[model samples]
Target: MKSPIRIILLILGFIMLLSEGFMGLPFLGGTYILSLGWAPLGSNITMYFVMFLITILDRSNESRSSLSTIAAVDIFANMIAFIPFVGMFLHWLMFFLMLVYIGIVLNTREYRGNTTHYDRHRAGETVREYK
Candidate 1:
């Protein structure tokens, strides 16, 4: 992805992380926010948008990031977020998981530093002769 776009996404992810983490607390009325109301639906849609944006904007051939995978799981959790106590705990857990995933996503590089021997062979380059 372009550097500017990547930075934008990283920023957006952090914002979402903060919003969910703080608002998810019971004292802050997180339960109500994640309840059977429209919040979960909005979050689910945001998750889908983020997943698709990352997958599409990211031109790298590497496999999808853990965030995408966790987002998939979050969908299920959101479904059950209608539950009373369980939903609150799940939201907190999801925040922690998102923290780890965002770290991984931020640290990942778009390109490998060097090509492997297999790449040389595939390109029909001469290999060093062995005795």
Candidate 2:
């Protein structure tokens, strides 16, 4: 994946992390959304659908196979996120997992060989010989 796209995903992950905290606030105040209705479950399912779409898109970028795998796992994690305690822990775990995945993506280079003339010169190769 491109650097800009990876950065955008990192930003989105942070936003989701923040939203996760906010979602817990009601629970602390004794206002359970789960008790109110099935809205929370419905929203979680909707989010899973959206994440599935993202996973499909990520899969199209052949260079980032690991990213697609991580995204796919994230979809399943979110699917079970409506469960009382397990769901909450999974959400937090997935957020951190995503951060790690983004770090890996950012650190990876698409082309490992040196492309600059200076690098070739330092390697004792004639710069003019490069195509």
Q: Largest lDDT belongs to which candidate?
A: 1
For model 1, residues 1-131, the per-residue Cα lDDT tens digits are: 34554576567667757755765678554545635465754665476467545755566625455556766666667677666667678778767766865676677666543475554545654466522
TM-score of model 2 (CA atoms):
0.54
Q: What Cα-based lDDT does every candidate model obtain?
A: 0.62, 0.56
Could you give candidate 2's per-residue lDDT for residues 1-131 as a string of tens digits?
44555566556556555545544453541245467553654554455355445535763344455665666676677667667677667756766666766566567554334455555445765669656
TM-score of each: 0.64, 0.54
Winner by TM-score: 1
Which runs of model 1 end up more than 4 angstroms from their true locations? Answer: 31-36, 61-65, 111-131
